[model samples]
Target: MTAILKTEHLSHRYASTWAIRDINIEIAQSGIVGLLGSNGAGKSTTMNIICGVLNQTEGNVFINGIDLRKNPEEAKKQIGFLPQNPPLYTDLTIDEYLTFCAHLRLIEKNKIRSAVEEAKERCSLGHFSTRLIKNLSGGYRQRVGIAQAIIHKPKLVVMDEPTNGLDPNQLIEARKLIRDIAIEHSVLLSSHILSEINLLCKEIIMIESGRMVFSDSMDAFNNYVQSKAILLRMDNPPAKTEIVKVPGVTQVDVLSEKQYRVYFDGSPEEVTDRLITASVEQGWKIKEIGPDKGLLDDVFKQLSSQSPQ
Candidate 1:
């Protein structure tokens, strides 16, 4: 399938400092893809370039196969954007605001009402249509922001921190709404929440200091770190020396009196099986044995720490 969005050698410079450098990205026809990075990591710069909010100092951006620089109007017609703060008219009622947005997107006068109504329905804002935007809660305001974005049914939707500042209940509602929106539009979401990204994104692109650090499927990222380690728990633990003697065991660290982290160099299952057998032979009653998960946090920390200042 052709990518709905692509960026090549993308970079942005502010006077003497480079905010982002040599970044490249491609989003397949559909699915939610995450853009992850620390604060000031160039995520905003990259998103702005793709959305045509900020022109890149270098490289090319293609939205639905149209060069963004060469044909900005046509390219942008395929994109819908919700910035960190939703651009909303506080005095306008929800229905009025969305109608104005539809008109701004150049929807025909005959179709604007249906388009506005459809957007309101999709965003669960049908009941709030008569309410002023300034009177809505943060969550409801976000819903209005999203409604405006999809008013034209763009092929790609870019959202920056859509869940920021939301309370627990609101966060849950927002996540469901974003997932619902993804069913019809390819989503490019930037967030600092790793767990949220893990839940919502099929593919992840991580950047640091304006440079790409990791890009691949979420499964691949999990597997990359999981293949090298195992978590072992025992009721009667053995000495570290004896534990390391197990076949394929390369390193052993005692996490606690009865828990250990075993690093190995062979197939995880084979190595884990060998360790279990060795423990059994030594009368170390096994309590639990499983692959060491929770590597995403570590990976993010490691990459972010290594990024140039």
Candidate 2:
């Protein structure tokens, strides 16, 4: 599939400091790509550059084959950007604000009404059209922002922390809108909320210290979970030495007197049999045995730790 957006050796700097460097990326035209990074990890900087709000110090961003570097106006016409705070006119009614967005995007004069209607309905703003933006709840306000974004039907939407400050219901509604858009438009979602990203994104791009660390589809990321970690809970103390010496068992840490985290990077059958034998032999009373590192938390920890990989 042709990428809706592609970046080659993307780099940026802030005067004397580097914000991102040597980054290459391609985003499918219809997928939710989560930009995952902790605060100060350069996610917003990258998003800003991609949206053409800031110029990249190095490399290029291509939108639908037009290089943002050489033809930013044309390239940006294919993108819709929603920063953390949606640019809203408090005094304007939802209809008026959406119309303004459409006109600014240069939507044909005759098509603006239908375009605005489609956006309003898509973002669930139909019921609030005549209400001043200030009269709407935060959730409705956000919907108006999204409504404006798609008023022009841009091929891709880049949102920074779309769910920030939203309550549960609002978040759910926002997520649904995002997923709906992804069926037809590429979405580059930036958020520090891991749980939200894990639930909403099909792929994840993680960066650290201005460089890409991990970038892959969610399925591939789950497959990359090393089998070396295991979580086991028992009612009794187990023989640690014997378990550690088993083939493929690398290290064993007793999280609690009853819980043991084993490092198992071997065949499942072999490891299971050994664990069973060890449990029976030592009366370890094994209650659970499974691969760990399902959460990106542990992986993040190991990657951030001083320990050598």
Candidate 3:
């Protein structure tokens, strides 16, 4: 099957400097795929080129078997985009705004109302159809933004930081809505948050310094960053020297008076068990103990080092 989206040597350059270089991506299935990168890492540039908002300096983008450059309008019919800041007309009612979007997407004149209603229903905005966009809360406004993106039922939806700025409850609702959207549309969700990607995506594509550094299944990415250390919190913590004395222990980092991160060369299970035994014997009350996955920056640094310079 042809990829819902594909890029070959995708690159873009600003007058004297390259914004991105030789990036390639392919997605053929219907599910959420994460585009992970830090700020200024060429994520927006790549998305712009793929969505036809900006022309790439050198590369090709194919949307569902159609060449984006050669047949942009037709290719774009298969795509939808919601940028970080949604474009919404505050004065327009939800119904009015969505109807306007349906027209923009070139939905049939007679079918526009049903199309609008379907989008509203899909995003759970049907009840707010007559409410002015400005009157709705931020989360509801976000739903409006999403409603517009899928108004025409595009084959692919590209969301940039879709859950950004949402409150905890809103985030839960938004994530669920995104998952529902993915059931029928391929979603390319982009975010710098590692936990967000882990929660929503089955596949991961990571870019850094304007180049592709990693692309694979989410499980594969997790396994690649296997934990080599365990974090411990205790009511009466042992000294760093005591932790170091444990068999197979390589190092111990004192995080706080009650917290420590122990590094060991042996299996985490074995080492953690030993630490538990030591804690019981030494009267150290163990509060928390688990593998430390390290920080996102650590993963980036490790992957960057492995990438060809």
Best-matching candidate per lDDT = 3
In order, the Cα lDDT scores of the candidates are 0.90, 0.84, 0.91
TM-score of each: 0.81, 0.79, 0.86
Q: How much is 286 displaced in model 3, in angstroms?
A: 10
CA lDDT of 57 in candidate 1? Answer: 96
Model 3 vs. true fold: TM: 0.86
Q: What is the C-alpha local distance difference test score of candidate 1?
A: 0.90
| Cα error of candidate 1 at position 309, Å | 15
Residues 82-191 of candidate 2: C-alpha lDDT, one tens digit per residue: 99999999999998998899989999999999999999889888888899999999998888888877788888899999999999999899999999988888999998
* Model 1, runs deviating above 4 Å: 227-293, 305-309
lDDT of 3 by residue, 1-309 (tens): 999999999999999899999999999988999999988888999998999999999999999999999999999999999999999999999999998988899999999999998998999998888999999998999999999999988999999999999999999999999999999999999998888998999999998889999999987887776678889999988778988988878998999889998888968789889999998999889999987755445676688667545
- For every model shown, the clashing-pair count is 0, 1, 0
Error of model 1, residue 83, in angstroms: 0.9
Please give, for residues 1-309, the per-residue lDDT of candidate 1 as tens digits. 667999999999999999999998998767899999888899989999999999999999999999999999999999999999999999999999999999889899999999999999998999888999999999999999999888999999999999999999999999999999999899999987788888899999988988998889888766645557788999988898998898899899899999988889978889988988888788999999987764577778876777553
